[model samples]
Target chain A: MRERSDDTLETPITSMIDIVFLLIIFFVVTAQVDKDVVDESITLAQAKNAPAIDAVDPRSVTINLNKDGKINVALQPMSISQLQQLLLAMRTQAGSAIPVLIRCDYETQFRHIDRVMQAAASTGLYRVRLIAEATGG
Target chain B: MRRKPPEQLNVPMSSMIDIVFLLLIYFIVTAREEVTEAHLAVNLPAPGVAKASENKPQMMEIEVHPGYLSVRGMRLPIQEIANTLVRLGKNDPDITVLVKVNLSARAEDLVTALDLCSAANLNNLNVVTLK
Candidate 1:
């Protein structure tokens, strides 16, 4: 029978802490940027090879459209007219640099998004990114 | 005779580790959920950027109405839409695909069409409204 050595095994707390911090930092960074695009109340559109969040202008307006084609801006439901007015105001205040991010339910009609796009273009803000669920194995 | 040293104890890391692991799990789950967003970058033509084409570019039309897709006024299965678009794009890379979507149709319907268009490498696509 082999005798066991008496040396105590340390749990490598330093390395564990280092790994923990790295993971937390990664999650924190991702969480920060994704907040603008996701909403539990609205189902996201799913597409193959949808661009990642970073592909979007970080300082962009996020508009959520429910399945019924209802527009949601800044967590509140509003008519498309009101939404347009608000976006126009924002565009004027911020200029063409402020891009718009449209997050609509996958089941939502394209006209819902089309209207929003028309509104953005009318305001001279041409950059628009649509959010969808990416698919791959 | 060797003296038996008193057993030294320190703050238990087990409890702290348990809490941290819990938090780590929470963050991981939330992160996965947040990262599910697959964005489609549709660069709508800037105001005044769309000019009239002197050459009547090849045109293809697609319609969306909830459970079905209509191509060139004929209904086609969604799965085959990409293949058809790809074949069409081969004939003319300058082909323009005009997507007419039902205003009340599902967003998935539009996305499915868009995704297939993209998969076929067709960049000249537009979502139009026939009001």
Candidate 2:
């Protein structure tokens, strides 16, 4: 009878090692976090019930409102009319299912945020999220 | 002649595989799918959502100014907001606070006032637009 080779019992690790390396690369690529639009000088208002978003909707627009009531998108300051136009465009492009996240500075007047909300509402963007800092327990 | 005794082969990948698995576990434990971005989600008063009714919601007006917050014509400091709202909310649970702020007022002041309404458990609110 032919003798069995010693290598017959050994399991190969090359495939699993390659898979793990690929997984590490995938995570590293996806973990690059973009800086949020809120300015460092501005303080965030406290809220008792504010919570981190749950199951972030893929179709979401984040607009930043500074203390000056200026709305900034991707670091470019925009007028209220411009913002309205943008919201109207987004609403038409993505449909009403998209949720809008407004990150207004804590010191920003409510009117600015309200104007944005009104614009969003006018464009049929009713679903909204107002970003704020969590208050102390 | 008797065949030479088989030589012992060292497994080169055992330790490397163990290290890779440890790293995999570490990444799996540390990775978060969603970042912690705090927010308050609300649905605006949609035309379809608001039905025509004679019994409209009781509305309360609160004007946000640069130096003070005016609730029902009484101007007060920002700190006095919660107490007043709690009292008003107690008087009428269904009171909807409508906030009208000057363009110059800071967002912090507005939110601080709004926080009062939230503290008083007043869910129906409208932060009126400037324009």
What local distance difference test score does each model get? 0.71, 0.68
- The candidate maximizing lDDT is 1
Per-residue error for A67 in candidate 1, Å, reads 1.5
Q: In candidate 2, how many Å is residue A83 off?
A: 4.3
Q: Per-prediction TM-score, please?
A: 0.69, 0.66
Error of 1 at A66 (Å): 1.2
In candidate 1, position B44 carries an lDDT of 62
What is candidate 2's lDDT per residue for A23-136, written digit by digit as tens?
Answer: 977866665334434344445676664444456676778788877777887677888889889888988898888778887777776657778888888988776877776653
How high is the lDDT of residue B106 in model 1? 75
lDDT by residue for model 1 (B42-125), tens: 556454454442134677778887778987677887767877888987888767777777877777877777777777767777
- Can you list each candidate's DockQ? 0.37, 0.45
- Candidate 1 on A40-108: residue-level lDDT in tens? 688776787434444656567889888777887767778878888988898878887786878888767
